[model samples]
Target chain A: MSLFVQTLSFNYTKRSNILNDVSLSVAKGDVLCLLGPNGTGKTTLLRCILGILKINQGEIHIGGRAIRSLSARELAREVAYVPQATSTVFPYQVLDMVIMGRNPHLGLISTPSSRDEEIAREALTKTGILHLENCLFSEISGGERQLVLIARALAQQANLLILDEPTANLDFGNQARVLMIINDLARQGYSIFMTSHFPNQAFLVCNKVAIMNEGRILACGSPDEIITDSCLSDLYSSSIKVVSARILDKPHKEVKVCVPMLV
Target chain B: MVVAIFFTSFLFGRYPVTPDKVMAILISKIISVPKSWTDTMETVVLQVRFPRIVAALMVGGALSVSGAAYQSVFKNPLVSPAILGVSAGAGFGAALGMILYLPWVAVQLLAFVFALLAVAISLFISKIIGGSSMIVLVLGGMVISAFFQALISIAKYIADPLDTLPAITFWLMGGLSKVSNNDVIFAILPITISIAVLYLLRWQVNVLTVGDEEAAALGVNINRIRLVVVLCATLMTAAAVSISGIIGWVGLLIPHMARMIIGPNFQLLLPVSLLMGSGYLLLVDNIGRSAGSVEIPLGILTSLIGAPFFIFLLSKAKKGWS
Candidate 1:
């Protein structure tokens, strides 16, 4: 297992628990998508896994070492986090932005060397945006910026990647592009943990899916085994349907999609 | 360029010294050159001009570097070295010392101590109110600054009009006319060490501009780095203000100019701000002393020049900052 959490519980204050005994695991090459409605402790769980928030009870282990026993640098070597795309105050170049991933590897007083730049460039190439290396990050389009952030996470050289809504603000085409990259990274044997509001996206990319609601994990399994009409409708308190439909006439390709019905 | 400005500054004082004579006087100290200049001229060059020149450079570089570091750490381009109320506290301390008839060294000491106290109070208040978020810290600073400013007003109000009042008023205007060799030597230690520490941590400061959680995710210790930057900046700012008496614009303006030229890479920006700030204050001080028979206060002139030029820069360029 690349990541394992056991009976995790957390609360901001002592009164109300935000996460209640949530436990899950991600093994190598597994793309685990956490699906939940708004304000359902999905982001809270991610924060706990990233060690940004301390869990009130339970233990988290990454790469077989206890999270509490690892220093920030050692933990960064095991896991990388990709935050949602946002503008920066300073107009850093794309290469400079990506090279910041090498910070965990460098000494306190040291800067990124030529070797680090090479690694950043290689990551950029892997994300298919190497040509934006010299452009200002603020000058790029939204989709390119998303790719740049992914490149930065790739440059961190961690085996486990945790992303918070990687396609949250992107348009449809960019969403597809980001999803394809996520699928490709999982194929290359990296363990991915991501949260999404779109259940249709889970069927496209994620091998494992977990549905969370009101601080609890309702179900956890492979997407094909866990994603059903009634489970999603109960989780979101809306009428939804899961249907398999054929899109092509000549070879008869079928896909499962989650559709919400309006009253 | 800094060296050229440094040497050129010696020619513009009240008692004029020729260029070659200035060179011979400087070189004679190093080697053995014929002394053609009079004793009074040498005294003016060595005693008056030399200490003032060194003081100007040190104070200017210290203020600018601290300003750049503060801006990066706060992630706010508008922040200055006094963002945490160090200047206001130091100003009040100096005013109180002068009204009480303290010695010059004692005045500087009070100012430095009070500056640190003010920042400590601001941090305490911020932590009590809303943790260490940047907005609350800034608000805490603003409240403390206003409180110190009121204290300064009270100190000035109680002073004798004929004696202590004028002295406090002049000191508040901010000038290096009283900077002696001892003052320069006293301030150089903290200023140099602080600037050196900030320069060494320049790369880590860059990591901070990516925002707190992001920097932490990258394995940079966010709180530790913020604390180090705040301490170094406060130390250098307090030292500079203790000696120079609240010269303002160099801290706020010079870093922006450096960013405009170098595009905000702290590795280059910190050093560039230092050099530019040194040359800038040297020129400003030259103009202050020689541009008129009676010296204009440095604090007044910096605001006079810094305000208009800042407005012009804001209108002209929109690329360096977000």
Candidate 2:
């Protein structure tokens, strides 16, 4: 249950080098929080790993097999991706939206199997939205919408779940609820990989942390090992500040504040 | 439900043939048994009218199903068959073939080919400009539509005012007059096959509702599948248009009606739209033929009735979905 990135690279437009020779490995039962400054290619890296963006150089290997060696369908069976945000241009019921995750498992023309229905229901329940199954997608709150999207990825039944900015848009309470769900899923043996700017969040939940800057991995270690005063200060040299807080028995974190150092 | 509508509609047409009379007519026509078969009743019940009625039923269903498929792929409720320049391209191709003295089959085939070519060119242009962007895909459809309409206008100007002009006018307006047994034979095969393919692959269409990248991630090949679906939808719509001439409103109106009734799954929407489309067209065609001393063109009859009903539908639709 390890996700490996080997020589992964990507391009945007005709211009090359959005991601450059970036590689990392996440072990079984690990929550790897990808911490990066803005425009550090966090979302691009996720797309390349998911096979949505074709690699210009090298390969992504999942469990010792090249990503190119597996069919898109086969690879999708191994990985589930939740994007930053999605807007349903057409208004559809929440149940219908959640059931779209059953796409890979169901036949081209066939209805969702009873097993798919059961799995989808369980995913919804895990995300704490089984009661909101009948609600219209457009009528839901943004945090609820994000949970519903997570429920969709969970329904894919992949061993590795990749999320892009899972809590980028949410209140403090909602963000914690989302992070708690991810932590619970990791405990249930699903490998969680996500990107975050909130170093505090990574310190609380992720056992392994990778900090990125300008399309390169600047540091990769455990939260306490990778984050230091100089590294955190240089990471945000322009206007740096740290606010310490202890949630008593929960978790304590040194949060970075203000604009991050880009160079 | 499509089956139920087909039989029920047959029972309730202008000349209401009783179930017993329908049986007698079927038997007499099969054996050519000599009896006092009045020519008008015989022609109405068997020869001239039956094929036209069946053709309308099939073609109307084809267009509506095509529209539903397009709406899903384009991810826009406003998309229709004509929006992709498909209808206009096929119309112009058929008109040119008819004016040049081609046979009906050749004309229909040519029309189908050009209609597909129009969509292909638009797809390619979208790829070149805004690769895989939804707004780019729709804008490409709009440009292709306007370009084909300019061609249609040119074709109308060059035709003979007396002979070709009225013929083109009638064809452009759409009707059941040109429907023959050969046309029915020709039309139903491709139409049935395309609709069957659509029904078989309808669930893949659900992926499109979420957006393309999500669809591609789910082991779905977006480009390959889009090509096949567009070809099938275009084939059904083009063949239907070649026979019925540009029947307006069925493609535009029926998907909305069906979505309202059965929800948004193509499993239900496809069949329901098929039934509602032909039934609505049949009602309009009946009025076109039987309303007065002179027969009005079917398109005019449809629009005249369709416009008011559509406006009423529009006012109600605005408050609910958007």
Candidate 3:
């Protein structure tokens, strides 16, 4: 099953609407990349979907259950979210930090199970950071910490993984690596929904793209169909163009989410 | 670990008894052996030093656990029970109680109530400034701390200098003197129960440290969890400050020390903190009684020792532990 929101809307200050009549269906194993600039309600939409923010005028259904009807743990079992990167105050070891994802699956009386450790270890191994498991998270590099966050999400074992700015502070290699990881996970049957400022990254990784602007979806379609000069020009409110590119001098790249402007 | 602390305390008091004798006395006491009609060592083990030892253990565990919880709730590392003004405010109340010649139970309860009042005022001020945000709570804690310190100063200024002043001063310094079985039971029972309860929900505390929104996203009832944690933590803190009269650094330093040892999982950190805190307090108490005829206050001893050890640990470890 997949998650769907019907006419979702949220207002800030109970006056101006931040999300207006947002409707979307995320099918199983679908990677829906929400491309938007800052304050375009991308994070707000994610919060509404995760039940962190209340939807003012519409309903959100996850796995055929209403968002409000499901318990927090039950909802967590369905949707795992990776939040924006903020500094951790304490010097918690990586193992302890990742093990917190097992909380939703546990009973009130049970501690983290052996299965939880195996899952965390597998996630860490998959992310190629298992060697750093004993090290403190605060002392890790930004890229490694980003991977640790993904591993924590993987340990959650939810079907739908949501991430906000997963590669916000990463270098070029780590950004590509994070996108590659998400692409691989999607191919392996995990539904991924993420927001990103890098439109090209979304073009390289996402199967479907929805561009949002001013609290509204400007366009939603396949990358090649929606990543057009007209849409980019209107969404970013600037002159933009996407040209064909070559890989090894073979004219093959057709869908480029490129926005080259000198302003 | 508590058992380890209890045994160490029983064996290493001022009236020195062998570990073997301490163990034998403990076994006889538990097994109901016929009373040793003439052995003073047995009385020392069972009656005189045992209550003091138990009191220190409870106070240490209670204060440190409260510290851990408050640190997590406030999302601030430097916060302790005293930051919410409970400890200092309770000192003021206890000083007032002493001046009034109130009974011991009455004085203890009065101090405990005043501590609760102090925390309530902090909570109220946090609300007044749109709390549930980390910065606001931290500010509220600072304000409450300042307010209570001023009140304590007033009490000190007005209290009779000869009898009450000295008593009040020593009480604020924290000692295991005047410890009784009843006081131990009273102080420990609530704290033990609260610690157990908080331990069961320890992961929530770790989640809270992440943030309110992120924690809410993880399916925690953010407000409810925060409230429960704060109440349970402050309750134990009030109980502890009432009995021990404001032991300081155990609450501030023990959790961080335990984090260094076992990492920062609250599940492991909780038990380690309890054990280390109890053990350290008992050790300091032993040193205090042994060093001089006049027993040193446990608070002074902890600050005197913990501060230097903290600086030493900071210097030796060069990676991200400040």
In candidate 3, stretches whose alpha carbon ends up further than 4 angstroms from where it belongs are: A253-257, B1-5, B11-25, B32-44, B318-322
Per-prediction TM-score = 0.98, 0.91, 0.93
What tens digits encode model 1's per-residue C-alpha lDDT throughout B1-322? 9999899988987788999998999898999998899999898888889889999999999999999999999998889988899999998999888988999999999999999999999989988998768899999999999999999999999988998998888888889999988989889999999999988899999989989888888888888899899999999899989999989889989999888877777888899999999988888898899888799999899889889988898788877454
Give per-residue lDDT, candidate 3, residue B267: 78
Q: Which candidate is the best by TM-score?
A: 1
- Candidate 2 residue A178 C-alpha distance from true site, Å: 0.7
User: Candidate 3 iRMS, in Å?
Assistant: 1.9
Collision count of model 2: 2
On DockQ, the candidate that comes out on top is 1
lDDT of 2 by residue, B1-322 (tens): 4455454444444665665555466579778665654566666666556787788788888989998888877787888888777887888887787678688777777777778788787888888998777677678878987888887788778888888778777778888876787888888988999999988888787676777777777767777677678878888898898888888878878887787766677777888888888887777776777777678888787778878887787776552275
For model 1, report DockQ: 0.72
Q: Model 3, range B112-209, lDDT digits (tens) per residue?
A: 99888888888888787874665777678678778778878888888899988888899899888778888888887779888988898887787767
Clash pairs of candidate 1?
none
Return the clash pairs for model 3, or none: none
TM-score of 1: 0.98
Model 1 chain B: weakest 10-residue lDDT segment is B313-322
DockQ score for model 3, please? 0.54
Off by over 4 Å in 2: A13-15, A247-263, B1-20, B27-40, B103-106, B127-137, B314-320
True contacts kept of each: 0.64, 0.57, 0.51
- How much is the lDDT of residue B239 in candidate 2? 83
lDDT of 3 by residue, A185-258 (tens): 89889988889877787678887888888788877777778888887777777788876556656666454548
